[model samples]
Target: MGRWEPNARMRLVRAAIDLCAEQGYEATTVAQVVERAGLTKATFFRHFPDKREVLFAGQEEHAALLTAGIGAAPEGVAPLDAVAAGLDALAASFSPEQHEFSARLTAAVAASPELQERDALKTVGLAAAMTAALADRGVPDPTSRLAAELGVLAVKQGFAAWADGDRDDAGALAGEMRTALESLRRAAATLG
Candidate 1:
């Protein structure tokens, strides 16, 4: 029983999410989270630099896998399609059991202004990483950045919908993201 105390970092996230779900994200304090997790500030600091960062843990491997997926995409595949596929492959790395906890964490992120700002910064960083990954595959400037943004946004929206819903469609996040990217294409066509 002592061996399974929610992995320290996950305990903090679970505590924060529970507090956020019960009250509001802004209303939840680090102290409250630590208290609920039966942990100290030292343990919290060891896991995350701050409260908002607790939600963004373990993204390094996701980026590495996404880059590899893009690099391995067939030459004929378009940039957006490649990105969609990459994100799908990334989603495949996580299991459905992780989805429920992650969904609550995401909701906590959405509910907090500080976390939302941090989330935006994280998205920009992800876009840059995607752009760099695609550039290595011979894709060019503005298009690469735009496609990365669109692809990630789609994945975010799709995951958000699935996470908030009571369905087993979290795997649908990649395809939903693809549809979002297509919608952007249609909208751009309308504008021009």
Candidate 2:
């Protein structure tokens, strides 16, 4: 690939994931990522502040997508339904080809405590974004928080299934997520 390629960021991410998968995240270095990407360390730094940031460069954009999805939900929709809409929108960003990459990325994160911490923090940040979005949609206090948590759970479970499950399509992954969300709703209804 050349420097003029339109997917330098994605190339860097793929390189990083590939290197991390082969050697383990703790053992991988930025130089190796750049080399694997056929790019420069400067290019990598331009896209990401550090190696860890490579795994999380989409955080702000994803949060924006989720919030936009929530904001676009039909008026008077149920909170969890609104969350489901947002999750569906978010899942649309992941293509069928990205599933293996996602699986590799998950495995790389699992191998590094630091990467795992970053992943947790990213999840919390996303949950906080969803909570604010839900609140703006007039969802109540504990309900908004709970709804946001459940939304995050659905996304996490959906991603795991999409990355590790037998299904290959984004639509199928979204359906599986909706099923998981419904399951949560059913389980919640059983309470009190």
Q: Which candidate wins on TM-score? A: 2
Model 1: CA > 4 A from native: 1-6
Candidate 2 residue-wise lDDT, 69-139, digit = tens = 88889999999999988888887777776776889988888889999999899999889999999999999
Model 1 TM-score on a 0 to 1 scale: 0.83
Off by over 4 Å in 2: none
Question: In model 2, which residue pairs have backbone atoms overlapping below 3 Å?
Answer: none
lDDT of 1 by residue, 88-157 (tens): 7777776565566767778677777888888888777777778888898788898888778776676677
Clashing pairs in 1: none
Assess the local accuracy of residue 155 in candidate 2 as a C-alpha lDDT between 0 and 100: 81
